[model samples]
Target chain A: MITAERKPLDEIIAMILPFKKVLVVGCASCVGECAAGGEKEVGLLGSALRMDARMTTKELETREMTLERQCVYEFIDRLTGLIDQYDAVLSLACGAGVQAVAEVFPNIPILPALNTSFLGQTKEAGLWLENCRGCGDCRLHLFADICPVTRCAKQIFNGPCGGSQDGKCEVNPETPCAWHLIVTRLEDRNQLDLLEEVYAPADWSKKEGAGPRKIVREDQQN
Target chain B: MKIESQLKNVLAAGRFAVTAECGPPKGADPEAVIKKGRILKGYVDSVNVTDNQTGVVRLSSLAACVLLLQEGLDPVLQMVVRDRNRIALQSDLLGASTLGIRNVLCLSGDHQSFGNQTQAIGVFDLDSIQLIQTVRRMRDEGQIIGGEAVSPPPYLFIGAAANPFADPFFYRVIRLAKKVKAGTEFIQTQCIYNLDRFKEWMSQVRDRGLHEKVYILGGITPLKSAKMAEYIKNQVAGMDIPEPLIRRMKSVPAKGQRKEGIKISIETIQALKEMEGVHGVHIMAIEWEEAVPQVVEQAGLMPRPTV
Candidate 1:
């Protein structure tokens, strides 16, 4: 689930105040799951905007629309003819969806209503915790499904640093030591021997230093 | 009753208590908060300041409510335990009490995934019912959630939320009953569009003797456009927009649709007021606070009853 907190009502209102007709677009995928840019939120935002506009001099006209997935071109294309109906578009999707809207409708001014945070999973019904960085690499197989890249304060590739205390990270005592989690999981699975493998220093060049990365699936391509 | 005695006296006089909702400013803008407070001042009995509403962070609800208090409005600090554990929730309640914001509406806010940070963890340490009970226990017994006696436990007129139209209506009502048991003095339902269904549920509430225990406030948010109406029907759970209403919204001249939306809301509120167990209506115009006064006036509700 893509978790997003709504930008403050005033900030969002201020951004769209200059526009006459605004489309409050919501994403039915992640933003919907998180409740930020979902259909309900779109209605709530549109209602709020309408109320705000009524209070102001402009008396703006606002509409709401939600797509199945905002990041996909098919969903973005759904708004092709509808784009002209509004002076600007307020995308409730993640950053990717906002960019997708911008890319698809280059002429329309696109504003993001949510600050896209991170790749996470719903621990329960409404809670989403960051679990992945989409680092273009999978090291979880070695670390018992815990990604030190995300959970570790240092993003260390090797064993626990001296800072780990009582299974908690010393950097912030509230945070659990990522290496400790990894060790615990390995120990549970009776794969603690995996920790014996002295891995070389991570090649930063292959990760952050590699710049923008892409994968071309020849099978899926025409 | 101990703390709400004064407000109860006002309610007993057959004067409709006015309650307004103030959505927290998205940013730290005192002007917006103050402006909203001023707009609702003297018109509403109490103003509800929503907490990180819908899991979206704005200015904190407590800060906004405190600001409203400073602005001379009786602010009902809306609290959601979705993001906080009992410890933090109790602390915030204590903080609100110390700040002299008396009224509180406890809610299990929308899932954390609904916000901009989709990956944020939700700490549903306590659901709305438990939260209400916790507040009651603290107030009546002067004890923390762990049963430890606290010096000078805060007194609050704790409120809870319900969705009569939420699917599986029986369960929603059951939960409402649970909330009443947990010490919810007031039950403000989710935005209700279908009055017949609401009336039916209110009848059930009456039958169960739930209405006697708590004041039931029907939630109403006006639909501004056909698209907005459709979103409510398709997306919002426990919310239903009758086809006629949707068709009416669509039939309106493009420019006149907003007026039509307001009309529908007014009719809903008027009809809801006629329901047997319905005490008052909680108008959640979302950002449409301006329309709220108009809706209330059109529905023949006095802006504020004379003391």
Candidate 2:
């Protein structure tokens, strides 16, 4: 899922400084699962801003709205009627959510309250580990279900680079070496010989095209 | 005539190849590069010009390679993936090649956290292995990394770094084999202080018959002082300095430590020269350039082979 973390208070404050009234938008999808931009987070941010406004010379009004999923137009339509009451929207979803709000209401400004971190999974409460690079080519089957593309620092399929120690990465000693995990898993699966087979350099054309990515299903479109 | 570099020629002729590192000074003084190049001129076959080795900003490795060329020293332009995306790295590879730099060492550089500026963003668009294949494609197939063909291609003899002491030691040689498979012609290992571990690594390399496929250059950096030895053994990552070596450095008084360092380096080089699958010695006399000639002469590698 697309994961993100809330922006710092000062940065968020600066984003909504020009607006006298703002809607704190939240999503119930990936960002909600990460606890970064859920309904609870929207209430906390709205309360914090309201409290901060009480201390300042200018009075600021904040409204809270949580959508089922902020990335879709149908869910985002929940704000169409109430959006005119506020000057701007402070979206607490991933980057996609901010765009969704802007696209739904083109006249109102949409400010992202969280920085989208990565395509990842929550390992435990408050702990998220990146698991995908969206390289468009998923070769996890070849490597015992481990994604070296996202975990390895260099993103080289032929690695563990020389700095890998005790199955830990040289870049961050705390992080496990992605290739080590792959190799050990392969060994356990009696596929050690697969390590000898070299892989071609990743093709960026399919992974990163000239612009943004798109997937349109003609069957589902109609 | 098909060979593009003197280092390649030495390796092709089956002679013990000698290469050392020359870090471009942080400041804008070309004289320092020239001085270091001259000191290592006849002592080593090729000098590796480091590209912001620890990520602390220095003279660009590309520019330093050009300066070393003016000094009549064969410069092995060391490029790290830590600082460049595919566009910049490939463009620099072509630029360095056209500027007469023949030998290129592809490396995934040290983490930026180790450098002076900790806030820098690392651009590891392609790791060392992929960089090797990318350069190979450009040189051999006249194609860019994006699969676009170009009129003129850059010719280069590619090299990559290896570390025998790094953990999961069983996989070091496997990784080396992988790099060789990725088109790396030569391999310069991380500094060798623990000979037993390095020998163990070489045995694995022999078992896989990787030494025959690629020229393996053992890295040797003389320990200047006991503090340096301790710092390397404890502080440095991916190094394997045994407790005995560290104790030996401490055994010597402060004044005699440099001499002890040189002696240890010479002895290490001699032992490595006799080892099977060991192609040559890459003496990385960091900052002590003057000590290099003496070490090379004393190690009986004085008359470098002129192939």
Candidate 3:
């Protein structure tokens, strides 16, 4: 899922300082699952902002709401009526959600309260691990289901570079060496032959094309 | 005349090859590399110029190789994948070939975090093994990765680095075999302080018959001091400096440590010369180029053969 972390309170406070009233919004999708931009987080942020406003200028007002999903237009449209009451919308959503809200209510100031980190997995309650590079092309099967393109620090194709030691990456000792994991899994399955094959250089245009990427299903389109 | 690799020719003639490293300067200064090259000339076969080794910014390996060539030294262009995509790597290979570089060593370079430029993004678009195959394809097949034909192809001796001391030790030999299969003609291993583990890796290479498929050069870096040994053992990733070697270095007084380092290097060279499947010794006298001639001569590897 697309993970995000809340922006520093000071940065969020600074963004909404000019406004007399603000809406602290949240998304109940990936950000919600990570406990970053859920309904509870919205209440926490709104309360904090209200407290800061009361202690400081005592001139600002805040209201909190969480949409089912902020990226989609249907869910985002819920804010069309309530958005006019607030001077700015502080979104506790991923970058996509902030952008979607901005597109829906083009006139209002949509400030992001959270920084989208990565497309990651919630490994545990307090940990999120990046598991994808969104390279546009995937070859997980060739590498024993381990994605070197995403996990390996250097993104090596035929690796475990010399820097790999004790199954740990030299870049970050905390991170397990991706190639070691790939080679070990492949070796366990007696599928080491897969590594013997030299992979061609990736065509990066798929991921880094001329501009933004889009997908359309013509059959489902009205 | 098929390929102009002097290192390959020396190994082909069944003579023990001698190679050493020449790191490019941190700044764009030609004399630094030339000075090092001059010291190593007449003492080694094809000095390997490192490519931004340890991710520190330096004069390019290609440019430094040219400088060494000017000093009447055959240079091995060390190309790392850390800072280049396929296009840049192939372009540099072609440029190196055209500039009279006969040898190229492919490496998935040290991570940028270790260097001064810790914030720099690494561009490992292709790893060392894939780089080897890319060179092979460009040279043998006269084509780029996209099947585009070149007007004239490159003729080069390809090499890659191996680390037997790294973890998953059983797979290190397999990785070497993979490199050999990828068309690497020569392999220069990581510095060997743990001879027992290296010999074990060599045995596995022989078991798989990979030793016969490619010429293997044992890496020999002379430790300048006991502190250096300890630092490498503790701080340097992927290096396997056994405890006894550090203790041995410490056994000697501070003034005599350099001499002890040279002595250990010579002993390693002699041992590698006797080991089966070992074709040469790559003396990496890091920042101590003056010691190469002494180590080579004292180890009875002087009077480098001219192939």
lDDT of each: 0.77, 0.88, 0.91
Score residue A202 of candidate 2 by CA lDDT.
Answer: 69
* Candidate No. with top lDDT: 3
- lDDT tens per residue, model 1, A43-126: 999998898778776668887889999999987888988889889999999998999889888999999999888788878877
Q: How do the residues A18-84 of candidate 2 rate in per-residue lDDT, one tens digit apiece?
A: 9998999999899999998999999999998888888786679888989989999888888877999
**Candidate 1 — which residues are off by over 4 angstroms?**
A1-222, B1-9
Q: How many backbone clashes does candidate 3 have?
A: 0
Looking at model 1 chain A, report the run of 10 residues with the lowest lDDT sum: A198-207
Candidate 3 segments whose C-alpha is farther than 4 A from its true place: B1-3
What is the per-residue lDDT of model 3 for residues B191-303, given as tens digits with 9 covering 90 to 100?
99999999999999999998889999999999999999999998888999999999999999999999999999999988899999999989898889999999999999979
Off by over 4 Å in 2: B1-4, B116-120, B137-153
Best by DockQ: 3
* DockQ value for model 2: 0.52
Q: What is the per-residue lDDT of model 1 for residues B136-212, given as tens digits with 9 covering 90 to 100? A: 98999998866799779896787878876643344445556767877888878878777778778888898889987
The candidate with the higher TM-score, 1 or 3, is: 3
